[model samples]
Target: MSYELSHLRELEAESIHIFREVASEFERPALMFSGGKDSIVMLRLAEKAFYPCKIPFPVLHVDTGHNFPEVIEFRDRRLAEVGARLIVGSVQERIDSGQLKEEPGANPSRNQLQTPVLLESIEEYEFDALFGGARRDEEKARAKERVYSFRDDFGQWDPKNQRPELWSLYNGRIRKGEHIRVFPISNWTELDIWQYIEAEKVEIPQIYYSHQREVVERDGMLIATGPFNTLGENEKAFTETVRYRTIGCMTVTGAVESDADTIDKVIAEVAGTRITERGATRADDRVSEAAMEDRKKEGYF
Candidate 1:
């Protein structure tokens, strides 16, 4: 029987092609490793792009100082396993230097503060192109972004002025002090990610699976009650089986009540879900209708 590329295989091939293109075109390209499922998938694609040799570029993480403990641990472990260099830009240092101001609210999140730190890191490292694992299906703003998203000298993105990409041709053109954000899996959906994770047996952080955690309900979302979100007198904490559909800063990233502890179950869950990952899980996105778009215009990953 004649066989064609399965959906997973097609996605894999497209991602690998994008990785190779990024490697060849940009002089100083770096992979943005957030220790999330998407970034982990990007790392795997990079690994496959240049097998029998080390991934030629360093991985960068704009540490928000409010990450899940499990994700940070997994970041280090994955780096060691792949023997890839990791460069972390500290949000703590930015806050300490007064370059970045901490959010003063009951729900303080460093999610917005990450933009400047990421831009500074790019300038410091002189990285011309940055590989991000942002998929279009995650948000409407991301859906508007091109595969090779060009940024200005100040790291601002003009979504309306993006260069047209046709027939898999990527335009990596950018001026000095300007850069591009390259997304390999921009075409993949959330279910596709979970399916790939299961098929490849990828090791993700424990938080992605079902676990008991103390959470409080606020703003129509379940916020994990931790150091990031101090329990208020009005808000009572309760333990529940929950897992993160999309992971971000601990303060802003909400977990959905779920019992999908295994990858197989997660795939099943994702398949049946009608809401987008960020819509269900990210409190930051709920700030405004154009929150993500505004952040993207300001150089957010």
Candidate 2:
């Protein structure tokens, strides 16, 4: 057979092209980095994309203040290694200032509260573009987004009003108050990301691998232990071997029991999994049918 680029190679090249285009075009841009696998992989691609020249943008983190320790540590270390500046958008600040009302319960997810903080941060920085490491195959709403998605001055996205972009040409045109949300690896699936992590030898958080953690079963998903959330009345927490499929605030995110200690194994696990990543772990998304879509309209990442 004739020579052809592997899917991983093709994805890497595509991300690199998009990164270069963003760097060349946008004046004030920021990356939404949550220290999750997707964001980690995106950072790695950026390093390769702008090799010789350091990354031209800073990473913005909308911290729910309920993140796993491993994830936060990994985030700090990775940013240090790449020498990229980090800007944190804290949900606690919003709560303390009475901007967002905290949910009253033993278990509460700050996922919904992050929208206002993220939008405020974007406005504070006057960012003309924001690069988010969101994948299409992860969720249904994401599938509807264009490569270069546009948001209005109010930070709302109208799916029906999306510009018609043909060929390789992405329309980044926007008004003064509006901005573009770029997803370089929009077409990549969960399996593809893990495969790339394996092939590229990128370092991810230790929680991705199987480990012992205090967990409780809630609505068919394993909710992992962390600060800022408590156990349910009938539901009791216990230690078990588990790993996070997707990483975010501990309140909203869940884990899966897998023996995937290495990247190769993780890729295999993802390839065989039946449920979508978000469907399995994201409690925020489980809130409503149009949750993610609604959040995107309200300036959530």
Q: Evaluated with lDDT, which candidate comes out highest?
A: 1
lDDT of each structure?
A: 0.91, 0.86
Query: Tens digits of per-residue lDDT for model 2 on 192-221?
Result: 898888887899999999888898888788
- Candidate 1 lDDT over 1-301, as tens digits, reads 8789999999999999999998998999999999999999889989999998899999999999888889999999999999999999999899999988998877678888888899999999999999999999888899889989999998999988889999999989778899999999999998888889988988899999999999988777788887777877799999989999888988888899999999988988989988888889888888899999999998887
Q: lDDT score, residue 105, model 2?
A: 74
- Quote each prediction's TM-score: 0.97, 0.96
Q: Give the TM-score of candidate 1.
A: 0.97
Give me the runs in candidate 2 sitting further than 4 Å from their true place: 1-3
lDDT of 1: 0.91
Q: Look at candidate 2 and tell me the lDDT of residue 27.
A: 87
Question: Candidate 2 has which clashing residue pairs, if any?
Answer: none
